[model samples]
Target: MYSGQSIAITGAGGGIGRAMAEKFLAQGAKVAISDINTELVEKTAAEIGATAFTCDVASEEAITAFIQGAEAANGPVDVFVSNAGVGFPDEPGGHAAGGSNESWELSWQINVMSSVYASRALIPGWKKRGQEGVKGRFVIVASAAGLLAQVYSGSYTTTKHAAVGFAEYMAIMHKADGIKVHCVCPQYVKTNMTKGMTEIKEGPGKHLEASDVADSLFAAIEKDEFLVLPHPVIKDYFQAKAADPDNYIGGMAYRAKTIDKGHIPLQ
Candidate 1:
């Protein structure tokens, strides 16, 4: 589906970012992998024969430079994936427990503002093309926690929600300009972010693999789906929450208490 395209992927060093990069490269797309970890990014780039650049997505200058470099090397960026993110540490007084200001601010910058910066930098360039053969595309890898309240992480949930909201706004505003915006909200995937989480085995509510999530993203892009949910259960959960906000919150609170009891041992 992404044949003959030049794509730029942030956070391409590990986890879902690396999986998505491999998938895109296998489909005959030239990719530029960007990440803050220069060594890992370069290693992945060499392994996949893709261009590599060091970019801190939270920084406007870094993102702008990376985009310019990618365009210069691989022609116009047909697809841009804003996928860099950080998880709040599991601590009593951290963002996960809603205590520290630093953790919350840092999470907001990386998880939420990074997407905003990428869109701000690239949308103008995309618009300048003016009704091209194929529209430029942007995808934000949000989390299912965005749509549903998370058990502990306040910063992660809040920032991811903002990311999804921004993606929706971008889609609504730029659809007429031939810009395709998509938000990927996946549940617990087997990634570094969820490495130490308590595994839940309730039917299909179990953890999803990174490659599976990446495959879902490819399908979503092919269909031009706005919300790409790797975990189908999350859709039902979202609907249930939307149907009855009060009941949903009450249920979530109950579940949170249960999860907390289990998490105490892990901590």
Candidate 2:
């Protein structure tokens, strides 16, 4: 179904973004990828046969430029994946708001505003396409942290929640405008962001590989679904959270009590 479609993905130098790009390319789609690291992104493009651009997704102008360049290279984007994100460690003091203002602001920019900018740039074209009965797809690679919470990363969790909210807003307001929105909420993945973190070896919440995430996304797309849960168990957890907030908080707090701030792998 993706054959000849124009696909654009952010943070594609490696990890989940690269996996998404590879999956789409293998499906015969014309793919364009961007990352903040020019050298790394260029190398990834060369290796994967995708058009490459360097973009700091924290900047709106950069996002607009990336989208325009992607369209120029591969026609208008049929699917645009906002996959770039940032994570910050809360200070070792165990305070909820221990992160610096800069970290929180950066998180807000990259995790929340980047999607807004991309959507702003894509919506007009998407609307135009809608008039022709074609729908544009927008994917947000948010975290299960958005729905629940990431214990030590205050900024990441908050901003990711905002990301999910904005995705919901867009989906609610633009369904008739030929826009399809998908939000990915996974527990943990084997990305650079979690490179030094502990990976659960067995049972539920086991850390996933990048390709596993890409596979989940494709499965969601095929099913015309909204939430892409790479870790299916996250659904149960989310339901449990909704069912009993007090119990969920108690359980989370107990589980996190022993986690030292020094151990968190800040991305």
Candidate 3:
């Protein structure tokens, strides 16, 4: 689907990002991949026949450099994937629970502000090009936590919500401008992020692979859809949450109390 396009993905060193890079390459796209880790980024890029750039999406300067370098190496990026995110699972105090301010700030920067940075940099160019019949795409790799909520990690849930909101705003505000926006909300995937996470408990669907998410993402992009729910069950869960928030919150609390080792209180 991405044939003859220039695609750039942040956090492409491993997991979903790497899977996306591989998928796009197989579809004949010029892929530019970046990650905070220089070694992994180089390795993934080489393995996938993509351009490699070391980038920390948490920093605006780094993001700018990555975009510039990727464009130079490939071409003007037709699609930019803001797929980098971070979370601390077992921290004592996190999000609202008295976690250190630094952790919260990091989560905000990586999970939320990274997409913001991409929009800030790309929207103007995309708008100008869109006026001339050229369109650009932005994809956000958010979590299902963005739609419902997570029990143990406050930072992940809160920042993912922000990410989803930002993606929605971008899509709603720019559809007329020919700028396509997609937000990917997936349940637990067997990625590095959920490596040691055992609180997952019994879920409707089993853990997904990174490739599964990449496939779902491109399918949504092809249809110009705003939201990509890889697990499919998340769509129903999200609708349930929207239909009755109080009942949804109560159910979530019950699940957390029953399955989460964090011992998070309902109050």
- Local distance difference test scores for all models: 0.84, 0.92, 0.85
Q: Score residue 135 of candidate 1 by CA lDDT.
A: 73
Candidate 3 lDDT score at position 173: 93
**Candidate closest to the true structure, highest TM-score:** 2
Residue pairs with colliding backbones in model 3 are 93-99
What candidate 1 gets wrong by more than 4 Å, as runs, is: 89-97, 130-133, 260-267
The digit string of per-residue lDDT tens for model 1 on 50-82 reads 899999987989998999999898888989999
Cα lDDT tens digits, model 2, 130-239, are 34644799999999989998988899889999999999999999988878999999887888988888777677788889999999999998898999999999899999
RMSD to truth, every model: 2.4, 1.4, 3.2
* Model 3: residues with Cα > 4 Å off, grouped in runs: 90-95, 130-134, 198-203, 260-267
Query: Candidate 3 residues 102-150, lDDT tens each?
Result: 8789999999999999888888887777335448999999988899887
Question: What would the TM-score be for candidate 2 when compared with the true structure?
Answer: 0.96
Clashes of each: 0, 0, 1
The best candidate in terms of lDDT: 2
Q: Between 1 and 2, whose TM-score is larger?
A: 2
